[model samples]
Target: MEMRAKKSSRSSTSNTSGSTTTTAVERKEIERRRRQQMKSLCAKLASLIPKEHYSSKDAMTQLGSLDEAATYIKRLKERVEELRHKSASARLLAAGSGTRRGGGGGGASTSSAATTTASGGAGSSEEAGRREDDMPPAVVEVRQHNDGSSLDVVLISSAARPFKLHEVVTVLEEEGAETVNANLSVAGTKIFYTIHCKVRTYVR
Candidate 1:
């Protein structure tokens, strides 16, 4: 009878230990899965921010490809308007035709020309808009993919945090730019990442 009791006690202890080990293993797996899920969420969220558009205004004007004659005509139109504004036809030359600067609609006509100082109003506002249209967008294309194969992208990201290397990789991949290599640097309060990627040709 004592032997039976000892055997039963051993079986109970063994079963309890096995169950405890199984529970520990299950808890560890659950933790790993949770971590993976959280990381995935972080990456998805990071990919939404847009990249800064950087370019020179002069470079954009060159892209317009205006013919030389058309460019000259535009210059002539602006000059005529300047002359009209100053009332500087040969008739108003005594008022000081102001040595032909030939651009920028003349500064306010001479105060001595017997005219009150002009104040810009709604007409000036519209004229300002017209002048602004001549300015180019902030960014220009430094490179573009071939016509048979190209990709474009927009992204949004959290403003509060700096991304890890892998996180940035995830974002670029999402943009369809596969990463070949990366170089990085740090400046006060900012991080700069440079990436090199091969352009893909879509044969299909």
Candidate 2:
């Protein structure tokens, strides 16, 4: 009976030792897999960041890559806000134009009556002046993209002006702006142009 008990105790000790060894091996494997997953995730994150934001030597550490990604996200958020503000301003401008048209008819009629009463001999000059007043002035606005790789231009020009699309394109090309998209809309004798460009060089 004593020998049997000793054998049973020894067997149990060996079993416990074996189980501990197996558990240790399992833990090591789990840790290795976790590290591999983390490495893969870091690589994917680095891929999404722009190359320009990377290190000058191109040897980006994991922490450096993550930092660049954070900065890029910040810039994107700011760009979104800027675009929203521009959209709001455009809406307000449209509303104001509508209001002005509604209220300006009476004032314009009164002015015409006064002008006629003041002079009959200057009818041709008055008509010329009126035509000029009816036409909107030429407006050009150029904005750089947040990435510094592109430009957006909004141009409002009078239809009466001797403007040519090809000439404008040629000028932009000369200034190192490659036009990617060009849109034209006409409203009440005013020509609106929206041009999107990829810039190869700095344009003044």
Candidate 1 structure quality by residue, lDDT tens digits, 1-204:
999999999999999999999999999999999988766654443333222221223322322222332454566666754443233122212211222111123333432222443554545645755754553322111123454133222111122223345544554454445667766565554444455554444467
Candidate 2 residue-wise lDDT, 1-204, digit = tens: 999999999999999999999999999999999988887887899888878766555437666777777888888877874664355335434433443344336546656666677466367656856885776756666787778677786777666642356556666675667889999999887778888888775459
- Candidate 1 structure lDDT: 0.44
lDDT agreement of model 2 with the native:
0.69
- Backbone clashes in each candidate structure, one number apiece? 6, 0
Assess each prediction's global lDDT (C-alpha) against the native: 0.44, 0.69
Judged by TM-score, which candidate is best? 2
User: How large is the C-alpha RMSD of every model relative to the true structure?
Assistant: 25.8, 15.0
Candidate of highest lDDT = 2
